[model samples]
Target: MPNSLSARTWVIAATGLAPLTWGSTYAVTTEFLPPDRPLFTGLVRALPAGLVLLGIARTLPRGQWWWRSAVLGLLNIGAFFPLLFFAAYRLPGGVAAVLNAGAPLFAAVFALVLLAERVSARTLLAGFAGVLGVALVVLRGDAHLDLLGVLAGAAGTASMSAGTVMTKRWGRPPCTSVLTMSGWQLTAGGVFLLPVALLVEGAPPALDGRAITGYLYLALVNTALAYWLWLRGIGRLPATSVSFLGLLSPLSATLIGWVALGQALTPLQIAGMVVAFGSTIVGQAVAGRRSPVRSVPVAARGGTGVTNEPVNGR
Candidate 1:
């Protein structure tokens, strides 16, 4: 039991690297990457990473998985990435972050309906707390909300929420590693974005040293490694619990802005951070209690196995 608990804790922390790293994306995109080329940016973030992972894994989707991978990719990355970038471009950073913080609520609903997972009151409360906390930390009263950006944010959140539940439902192909699965999704998403980016944004922007460094960081560490960890977490933890970890993205972004960009952190923002982080803790604890700890098999731990569905049977 102790081992099981420890293993779960480790997985949770490792999985968290996804959102935590993602927090830096706003800074990177604004500072280093080309300006106003969201689709192209999304393309760079996903495609190269996908190709690299596919090469390393030496695996392709087989049978129904060919289409399944495409669908999941469209929802999670293809749609989510473009929309996320679009929203970021159209909206204030704080507004965009607050909109994204609503993802846990979307995940909770999707889990109940699609995955047949029961929603607990505590989890629901925690979800609300997460939203409020993020609002406090990042949202500014003077921030203007663009209608299109708001819609994009909502759509992106819903798209990824559905994807998260579906990923939990479909699990991965038998005997496939998380690396291969991530490759399939990332490649599909990149492919989907290709024509759209070209048509909407014209040719790619000129790359400088800073741009290259930013893309490399985003592709290798942010997208590839982070997504591998996230999908693995979805396979191990409850969908809603995994979604709750997304709160860290906004928190990470706000802190980065304050520390790296020299933006001021008001006392209210600090309190909001406490609230958001506290809610994440409560949500995870509630989820863990609901999901009784059991020993994870050796195969699941190795990242090469079937039956890598959520441990709570979500």
Candidate 2:
């Protein structure tokens, strides 16, 4: 039991790293990447990372995973990137982030329906509090709402939430390592994005040194490694606990903007960050106290836990 708890804690902390890396994306995109080419940018992030992981894993999806990988890829990456970018374009300030902060709620609902996992009141409240905190940190008083942007943001949030729950629902095949599974999804997502990017944005933008560096960083670190960790977590942790970790992205963005980009944070923003961080911590704690919520029965899972657990943390 102690070992199980330790293993679970380590998985949570490692998975938490994904969102932290993702938080830096706004800073990298604004400062380094070319502007107004979201689809192309997303393509760069997904395709290269996917291919690299696939090369390393040297495994291909078999049987149902081919279609399952495609569906997961579209939900988690291909569709998500475009919709999120669309919301970012249409929505002002941090409105998109605020909407996305509700992901825990979506994940909770989906977990209940799809996985038959029970939602605790504390987790639900934490989800709402996280939203309020994100709004405080990102949403500017002058920010105006666009109806289309709201829809896009909501859709993106739902897509990812559903994807997360589904990933938890369908544990990886016994023969496939998490790395290979991640590669499959990334590759499929990138393939899906290719024509869309070409059609919507025309030719890819010319890249300077900084742009190239940015793309490499995003592809290698942010999307590839980060998502590998995220999907691994979905395999190990409760869907809701993993979703709450996403709240860190906005908080991370706020901090990066403040430290790296010299963006100002108001008192309220600081407080909001505190609240959001608190909610994430509390959600994890609550989840820890509960019994492991199995998306699959023990016999089908080929026994308990991922064999390769990262060094323990948080």
Candidate 3:
């Protein structure tokens, strides 16, 4: 068996996969999913995936978690999804992802205010590099980056940033696993979105076999599995550090664009990828090693341990 530290490394790596997989959202939405149905798509992705996870876990939220689930579900899933899909549809693939890369900056500020965590100078540098790198990788003179898309992306980032910090602060119920927490939020978000989707979209669009396959991929792999791992990591890692992993989404999207869509990466984009990747590593490395759970172990180098670390304190 692996030692504690080594095991934590694997967990962190696993956490990284969630966003990396999410990076393909733009291409997936444009090519595979029904267009102009952001709300419907969002509903399907969140509701069913959540139900599946809930069915497997068979765990329910108790007491205050009912509202907590609502709040988290709205921010992390409901609002974020519509805004994200709106941006994805309006902007070029790179543009939306580039806007999302702003999440770490927002997360850092939220951590400082809400959790009292300090943003280090190195991390600031990392943020700067990350932004610059994303700009280089995605911003193109010819791409029509819409104002509405930019706003939607910014809103999505802010929504998710707040949700992420809040999740880290509150932690999950003592008996709850990440899957249960994710299920609660997903279910709540889906519920919130259902009426909105029905009201705005008229009805869920018809789907053929290809669309069904796409929705299944999104529900099972992208939303359900992704959120479970992400929530798990949030409870175990510094919220700000976890936010930094989001930069990988754009990079992953870029690669998918290149391979699947036959989009070409310029030399500048390749250089930017290096800087973005490097900055993400440095930010996480300098952000310290542990998350702050309330009742976790002292030596449980694994992120699963509960901690008393200040929301803003080391």
Best by lDDT: 2
lDDT of residue 109 for candidate 1:
98
Model 2, 184-211: lDDT tens digits are 9999999999999999999988999999
- lDDT string for model 1 (197-311, tens) is 9999998988999999999999999999999999999888888989999999999988999999998999999999999999999988888876644534435434224553345
RMSD of each: 3.0, 3.5, 3.7
lDDT of each model, Cα atoms only? 0.87, 0.88, 0.82
Deviating ranges (above 4 Å) for candidate 2: 292-314
The TM-score of candidate 1 is 0.94
Model 1, residue 305: distance off in Å is 7.0
Q: After superposition, how far is residue 29 of candidate 2 from its true place, in Å?
A: 0.5
Model 1 is weakest, by summed lDDT over 10 consecutive residues, at 295-304
Compared with the true structure, the alpha-carbon lDDT of candidate 3 equals: 0.82
| Candidate 3 lDDT tens digits, 1-314 | 13545555665688899999898776887888877887888898899999998999999888888898899999999999888878877887467777788888899999889777788888888987898898889888876868999899899989999999998767776657788889999999999999989998997788988889888888999899899889877876778888889888889988999999998989999999999999889877776544322345423332334543323333
lDDT agreement of model 1 with the native? 0.87
Query: Lowest-lDDT window of 10 residues in candidate 3?
Result: 302-311
Regions of candidate 1 where Cα sits further than 4 Å from its true position: 293-305, 308-310
